[model samples]
Target: MSAHPEAARASSSTPQGKPRKAAFAAWIGSVLEYYDFFIYGSAAALIFPKVFFSPDDPATATLISLATFGVAYAARPVGALFLGHFGDRLGRRKIMVWTLVLMGVSTFLIGCLPTYAQVGTLAPVLLVLMRVLQGLSAAGEQASANAMTLEHAPENRRGYYTSFTLNGTQAGQILATLAFIPVAALPDEQLYSWGWRIPFLLSVVAAVAGYLIRRNLDETPVFQQASADQDVARMPLVELVRNHWADVLRVVAAALIATASTIFSVWALTYATSDAVGLSKSGMLWASGCANAVALLAIPLWARLSDRIGRKPVFLTGALGCAVMIYVYLWAISTGSYPLVFATGLLFFGVVYSAANGIWPSFYGEMFPARVRLSGMAVGTQIGFAFAGFAVTFAARIAGPDGDNWKGVATFTAVFCVICAIAVATGRETHKVPTAELGLRPAKEPAKPQISESVSS
Candidate 1:
């Protein structure tokens, strides 16, 4: 089918967008949103097992705590459906503000919850509820930010502009890790009693900063033009399903690449610190922090390369590279070598995996037209991210009784990376496609008329 004519016309007539401003808003907003989201992850790995769950069975508590981390992923798709609709209909700015506030409030509340020692079953129950709220807020956060940035970006640099969102995410992860490093170093009594709560409470600062930036930010020209022309989809989810189902499916499959992240950030942290490996929590946290620090620099460079070449090659490179690197990283952790752990962690996540991480914002956003862009990206990516969220729980199960079966966990994560690579391999290349023409199928050429043999004779 052809591109939306109204959208194409609007693109031509609209004034130049504030691409840098939009990218900055996306970057800072994501930094805050994911900061709230990832602190839960850090706590789930290092603290929640002891505080929220029963101490009777350390094994079961660890398993359940990791499962709670996935609980947010389970809630994300539902949040995406609701938030994506409003983002497409009401405007990306509104949804962005709403998500930030919701995430901040929920995260802060998580810090206040009483632990199992204080409230028994109610403690974990409340934690799960808060995690679900975080999931809902995150559901719309990235998709809306990506759509806003992509529409605002210059035609030739969508990849570069949209990459800032993921860059912000890496920064947030770094921030979360850094926050936890000191907390993780506390004496066990102090650490479990009050230290972990500090990171969750700190989310308030991020919320305020994010709100200040996003409130003053201007809406994207493409969205404004669509609204002006009455080209906004009344039911973006329905429109996305009817016209863009294949792309949605492709996104869902490709997003499994996040499994690598879950394994790295959550499961690997748990494994390294477990009795079998006996690595220090602070040391592992430092390794992750350093890896994310490298990613902060690597993500933008890889994104610029995608803008110059195309999204597919860079994305595929990362996905395929991750499939191989997962083994090496897991091996490093199993060997009890901190230096090897840091080196492989940096190579796997910071450098190789970042190619896919940096490019997906643009690559996924460009798969649908402006009318359904928010909904399509939100729903597709969230569904896939759900699996990535639960992957830590699954990885724990597969890693044998000792939870030190690095090979088994590596094999499981590698399988998903391969699946993600295959999914992206089937997608349309959109880096070179004009911003207006994005998500539209190309026009087919007419067949030439055949000459009759009799007439020729």
Candidate 2:
């Protein structure tokens, strides 16, 4: 959570530099927010079917459990609309505080809910409601965090700084995946009874730690400058739709790449556990944990690569490469080849997709003008994320009892990659643009020169 050396060096006599403290503040806040989001993702796949839902039909249980997971996506855009307004009007800092507190309370509540045996139908009902709350809070979290960091970042290092926010997301995924390792290894009876609750309950610790780090940070100079000028839009959404509509649509299309990620992570876990593949849940969990760990390193490397080249090539490479690799990755799971699965799974999710993942926070945020940047990003991404929300259902239908349908899933994922490739290709390069120039009208006419009294005479 501490500021990096670059950030610290830039923060000196002149305030015209990187906001190291503010960026780190956003980084730590995003880490906490995603921690709350991803733990439920882990639980939805591994525990929720049995823990909260009816135990009758396996297929129905899986659908209902996945439905609970999708519930959060439902609230994402709504939260985006609500929270994003304040982020544009008030400041990125205030929305972040609310996002963390709301996610923390919701996640902690999920931990305390009674099981179906204890409370009957109320168990899953409360779980869905809590997931909706988490979804709503999560809607604006990453955008606000990324906006804070990007605004505070140096012109040359926007990709690098923005990527740090997602590294927090990957860190959260690592923690969420690792949290399941011990729990999944527990005996079936005890695991279902109580083991699964430990990870969710840890939200209290995360919430407190996040608050400590995030509270000390101040508003970014970009927003402060806009405020001082009394120039911020009363309706950021109206401006976003008017001027940045094309970019908003572009980000929406690009975010479909996320479907490949959530499906590969969550639904693939369920597929491996099914009778067709018969992989122990622990083995799958280890694969996920290590893959996420690899991403911690891969994300930064890819982000730096984007800084050197452009985001388009790197993003396309990642999407296309990951699409090709999913076939082998799924094949490894189906064949029960642990060595292959472990290696390829880590390679695909951790390394390949990371190129796309790390670049997007900045890429999407850069698409809009500063005034409506948060609103445009949050609404576009969460809406694009909706496809991924139902990906479990789509993947389930695609894979079915014909578990050999790895071919079908791979083809579907590849189509998604190609679509995103076209989308990101349209984006203009913003790595050199100053934060102040973003979302503002371009200057056209040449400036008039001052005249001396002698020249006038």
Candidate 3:
């Protein structure tokens, strides 16, 4: 296979890179995109059961609502394949703008949906359809944004620049949680009726803002050069599979680390505020908000550290640390100790998980040549994330009757974290490799002839 000429040019053209502007664009776009995506999670856990599903069986309704949250994940891989192909074929900037628009439109429509009481079975069906659209939009958002930032980043600081995408994500999560605090506090009648729609309706503003920002952004020079050189893969997915399948599988496994996020943000929220724990919904939201606020500071720092050291160590630290901390965080919630919950939540998610979250964009994007980078990252990560998306429903089922099975949920999450660590362990250390040489097989050294002293004489 031919080497990526754009990578060679990118390695030398540091001054031409738009690291700051591109990073900011990626950051703001993710903030809006994930804000739209996460609001559904908050509603699913807190409001959707009563509004969208049959109220006759509260337990069944809760499980079904959570399942609706996962419905987006099912659609993500499909979107990844379609959007990723065009992203590689057309350009990343176009896909970024499209995803923002789709997410905003779907989210706004979700706010306008009629409740189960109003429309009977059609309510959940509409909810699921909207969630699927959100999932599809999300499928391309991170991968395209990550590719844009990374290709525009200076070779030595790719981790730090790409980190902005996730920083935006953490910020979005904070916004989503905070948005729900006031709404969640409304009286049940008002909450079920109209208060819940406010957050979803607010997505239009974010979407419009994100669209404007993304549209003004220039395409990454790396991608532009590839296009000029006619180096863009005609079938990026086919090329990706032929040359980078193992890396794809590795990314799929490494991406499972996201299971921890869903469990913490969604399932744990439900568990903490359940009748069993008796924790206030506002308190849990505040705790989540605080942790994500801390993560905003921590993500770039961890990404910068990965730039200095390597993606593996920082990533492994996060994966392993999260494996242990899941137990501690969940245990804190189960004990009904608000202090411990806050402390451990900050430690587990804000500080520790940010290491993995901040670095994966750079780490995974580096695994493929520029030709296939977007497709590989999108397809592989989305497939793995599909499982992560459903993790809430699985956590609900594993928690058993009364939903006090915090340990079971913790164990399930921990196992995936460990798997993430192990998968990353087997992958190449791409940090030290030059941008031009990434995804190219290293040249084999010529064999030296063994000569004895007698033979030499």
Listed per candidate, the RMSD to the true structure in angstroms reads 2.4, 5.8, 2.9
Stretches of candidate 2 exceeding 4 Å from the true structure: 1-18, 402-404, 444-457
- lDDT tens per residue, model 3, 1-457: 2244544555565346688999999999999999999999999999999999888999999999999999999899999999999999999999999999999999999999999999999999999999999999999999999999998888799999999999999999999999999999999999999999999999999888998888989898878877877878999999999989999999999999999999999999999999989999999999999999999999999999999999999999999999999999999998999999999999999999999999999999999888899999999999999999999999999999899999999999999999999999999898877766678775556799987768554
Better of 1 and 3 by TM-score: 1
Q: What is the Cα-based lDDT of residue 202 in candidate 3?
A: 96
Model 1 gets an lDDT of 0.92
lDDT per residue for candidate 2 within 1-457, as digits (tens), equals 1123322222332145355776677767777788888889888988888889888866777877887888898789888888878899998888888889889889998999999878889999999999999989888888898898888888777888888888888888878878888998999998999898988898988788877777767777767767776767799887888888888889889988987888788878888888888898889988988998899898878888887887788888887887788787888888888898999998899998898999998788877766888898898998878777777667777876644476777777778877888898777876655555554455445788977668544
Worst 10 residues of 3 by lDDT: 1-10
- For candidate 2, which ten residues in a row score worst on lDDT? 1-10
lDDT of 1 by residue, 1-457 (tens): 3255644565578778899999999999998998899988889989999999999999999999999999999999999999999999989898888899999999999999999999999999999999999999999999999999999999989999999999999999999999999998899999999989999999988888888889888888888887887878898898889999999999999999999999999999999999999999999999999999999999989999999989999999999999999999999999999999999999999999899999999999999988889999999999999999999999999987799888999999999999999999998888987788888765556799998778644
The true-versus-predicted C-alpha distance at residue 435 of model 1, in Å, is: 0.7
Clash list (residue pairs), candidate 3 = none
Give the per-residue Cα lDDT of candidate 1 at 77: 99
What TM value does model 2 have? 0.92
Query: Considering every candidate listed, which one attains the maximal TM-score?
Result: 1
Using lDDT as the measure, name the better of candidate 1 and candidate 2. 1
What TM-scores do the predictions have?
0.96, 0.92, 0.95
